[model samples]
Target: MTWLPLLAAGPALAATTSRPWGVLCVGLLAAVLGAVLGIRDGVPGHELAIVLSALVAVTLASGLASALRVRRERVLAAVRSVAEAAQHALLKPVPATVGPFQVAVRYSAADAEARIGGDLYALVPTPYGVRLIVGDVRGKGLPAVGTAALVLGVFREAAYDEPDLLDVVGRIERSLARNLGPDDFVTAVVAGYPGAGRMEVVNCGHAPPLMVRDSHVMAVAPTHPTPPLGLRALTGETPSLQTLPFTDGDQLLLYTDGVTEARNHEREFYPLAERVARHMSDEPSRTLAALHDELLAYVGGRLHDDAALLLLRKPAAVGSAPAAESRASVGEPTRPSLLQ
Candidate 1:
């Protein structure tokens, strides 16, 4: 959480303005100052010429050094700014608190900042319920980022105004159909956590989200899933929503392919499900900490894509669990009242 933004801006700031490019500017300034000093001190001899020469040499060297650093810094800063904008667009700044869940997300791009990869998640409180989307766009750089923004924009609007999950998905499909390249498509899972304690999920060929219960981790997968969002037109019936039994104190983990697809030094994939199942914690924050740490350790701090993680805690339910059969017999139509 603490590891974001470069703290070493001292060099960048000094190198940018009025010859801020570190060494060059410094050297030039030093030379000018030296000449002024020589004049004031009245040394108009061979010694003065030698001092001027040294000052000129030093100034040129310093200027070059500073310019190189400034160039590097500007590129990094540009990248950071882009990543920040993408994050804002993807996350949409939901209220810090919603329902019994306190959600927090972290995204780290494979490149220092300027690198273009978009791993996205968006949560919007809608008339139908609280709708959210989490997924990774294919490719890297601006193309991927553009796709991410496109998907998020469609989902945000559709979630609020559309009642059916399929309809919301349809909106995104139409939007992408007009823009996405023939080979480009995003993989994702769009979900509606309609308040109370139930979740409606539509899997669009994305990684299965993890559900944490009493410290146990299980993947929340749909029984039937469609292809990723943009390719929906290629497929027939949309994926059906699978209702989940969410309770207070339960946590839902949504992530991008970056986390699961990470490769280790041995070239083996990061074992996200296995690791999460083994390390899940009762506390949402703690669970995330453990997962994030293990992820970083697995890849040795190198990631290949924009990795994102969103943790949601439903808060603890007041009453006892309904009979196991109760969930089997119940349907989503009857669940909205549970929010009360």
Candidate 2:
């Protein structure tokens, strides 16, 4: 029947990714085929012309649908481009080394399609020393992204201007309290190297960072508990800075819940400490690369939430210049606390 050809053309054109004209041509050919079949079946000349005319109409409709699909795809591409640019500006990439530390960073937004999300990480060399931060917002999508951006912007500015690490955290807390929703909060670990062999960390309701020294791994849990950034009012307690010995060949790993909370098919959370102990190395970059690969495999190649990992190592030669200075042309890939 003439209707059968129209039905077939509709689906074929709907699935085609080629130019609309190509699909239009296919629809036309189908219509002509139907007409040839009608003539062979001895249909009247006037009726055969009507059948061909109907096919032409079907072809035109198919072309219009194809055009709409292409237009939508172009619009989405433009949107993605804008999102990527925003990500670059907000999450400025870290150099391989800063001051006395060798560093590496690996970040993955749970939505692979999006270039940025709620997870945030940063590292900057300041007059005080090198400061860094890694944090995660409470929710997902655009609102979460906005909060993460705000936290990072304040952290960067305060890290440079305020000599006190606690002051840096105070600035972020004030900003979030002013701008964030009542229920919004961010869990973060802010740390800095005030001197060549000393490091200070302030934990804000975040996962405890892992310390690796001489092939051993241990959690750097703070002795005092502190609320996440936006809820400091509820607890009425400020975060305390924990100082540690960060000598040559020692590394510190800072991560969000995404790293430890990722589940496998069995619904078991990945054992980050045990795994890091197995893959620990003097090189921060190589260690993180291995960890990220294993994490993806554990989650079946897709993450459900934004993930961020930052590794900072005190080189054996502490006073010497960072290796990255010579490789400044190469891109390498933060925390608040003033440990004076």
Candidate 3:
């Protein structure tokens, strides 16, 4: 009779990983066992009834809890599906090749369940050239995501309409100034390859991009520091365009602070440039993949913040003829050479 109370644990444990029906089955089995045990011990009928009634109450409660849990899980799954769809629309996937450069991107949200976060990146082949932007919002969650979407939307439009690279940055700046709150801001690196063996970069208080030249990794620090987006009005300083030689076999890596700020058990930040030098490869995708794997392992299998990595490599020319220029939009079929 004393053991009859232990039967409640059967349904309680089942509620955690089984369906309501499974919990019901477990409860019914426990009740039957309790009855057998009570009779074998020659327990009083009233005492037996009391124990059985408590067991029944616990089982019913466990079944209801299981039902509610299953329903909540289904709702969460639907929410995640919608978030994924929104992410695809906001951060359209880039092809392996954009214009003359081989491009690769890797992004991870701090919230594993959210699947998308404040970190944002976009690479598109515009009439100006292959232009790309990598930026990190000031915060996380829904507000950060909305700010990132605003920046990308302005960038995609400005990259094509504006002839000058700085003008593209200007467009994003003005848009953010009008929309973002005084406390909100974004740090970004906007870069473009305009077909003159030169890569134009406009840094807005973001991490210095790593340039790989002749097997050497060097940080492309901005000559003139400027405030981040949405704070230009306060600082009254505009972003300056920095042009660098981007010849054949050269590569550039742009990433958010999350990569640099990631810490291990010892609280040591990830060495991005050093890792990039070690993982250098002819293919940008393979190189980023190796770096990303090492990064995750270095941080003990997870990053605490949203991290984004964009690597662009200019392949050595095969012939005098330039690669065919192409453009890709979301949901559109990519050209054979541009397929990722």
Candidate 4:
């Protein structure tokens, strides 16, 4: 470990700050004086014994401090390991490709202290088609994380069982209704590709998704206004479904409010659509990388809220796998092996 030497030196360095060096210097000086006196008077002196005892005590204290530092480092390392496991459990990574589209995800939690936060995104090739969801919970921290987990849990199961895009959303709505608090809700955009150059999007009071077509970018906002999930009881309203043409070479970008709301030093919100227009390309991953960097630069380094970006682009040709059978081509879910 690179930190080993630093950790070992911590106690000794701290002891120096506590004036141990001065004590050692004084003791040595006293011993020297005592030796001279003893030589002149032909008598043994207490100063020499006191200096030896002081040296022994300092050695013992230094050892004790080093042991404590090592223990603290071990505890911190274990805590970091557990945090990493939690992050992996919450934010499972998406493959480079899913169904008939190339996929890439870029996520950052505002709370840099923790790996996982409130924002959530997932893309799964289900029996119905390639289904995806990007949402932001009402609050931050652990409670928001729990809500996000609940939404994804329902989406993953419903995406496989329900063929209809609306039905998949309904499952998540019902789950949130039963689980969330009165004041809590989630703003989300759930999307799916059933086939034939058509993409269905259901917006639930979230930011509109941006679509890139032939070097042009536009927001895919729903025609009808809808309340966010979990607040359906309050509004008695349901999310509206939007079906749009997604031809080959076209790209779709789904993101949370964090992207739009991110501000630079001058307190200006990041212009997402304009930036996407500038960065749209054949590779979804590369486009997202550029956007992510610009976003960090815009925010002056750290984002103040959880941000998630999910990009999907249809290839020019379906290749060996037909669009109808794209679900079968999806690889198994990749789960990180936590330290056992």
Candidate maximizing lDDT: 3
Candidate 1 lDDT tens digits, 1-340: 1111121232234444535345445555555665666677776657666765665555555456566776888898886887678566565665656655677665668885453466788887788877888888878887888888889888888888898987898888889889998788888888887755687888888887877665555676568766887776676656677888776666778998788778889988777666766766655567677878888888898786778888777754468674332233122221111211
Q: How many residue pairs clash in each candidate?
A: 16, 11, 0, 0
RMSD of each: 9.5, 6.9, 7.6, 10.0
Clashes of 3: 0
**Per-residue CA lDDT of candidate 2, range 1-340, in tens?**
4454454455365535756887777776677677778777887788777767766776777677788888999999998999889989988888888987889999999987788999999999999999999999999999999999999999999999999999999999999999988899999999989984678899999988888766767778787989999999878999999888777777899998888889899998888878888888888999999999999999999998889999998776746653332211111111111100
TM-score of each: 0.75, 0.87, 0.91, 0.78
The predicted structure with the larger TM-score, 2 or 4, is 2
Please rank every candidate by lDDT, starting with the best: 3, 2, 4, 1
Q: How far does residue 328 in candidate 4 sit from its true spot (Å)?
A: 29
Q: How far is candidate 1 from the true structure (C-alpha RMSD, Å)?
A: 9.5
lDDT of 3 by residue, 258-318 (tens): 8989889998888777777789999999998998999999999989999999999999778
Candidate 1 residue spans exceeding 4 A from truth = 1-55, 64-79, 94-96, 317-340
Error of 4 at 122 (Å): 0.8
Model 2 compared with the native: what TM-score?
A: 0.87
Query: On residues 1-340, what C-alpha lDDT tens digit does candidate 4 reach at each position?
Result: 1221222233345544434454444444444554555456644446445544544555457656555666777798897788789777777889999988899999988977687888998888987789999999999878998998899889889999998898988999899989988999999999999987788999999887877766766677678878999888888887778888776777888999888889899988888877887788889899999999999999999999889999999897835443442222111221211100
Candidate 2 ranges beyond 4 A from true positions: 1-7, 40-51, 318-340
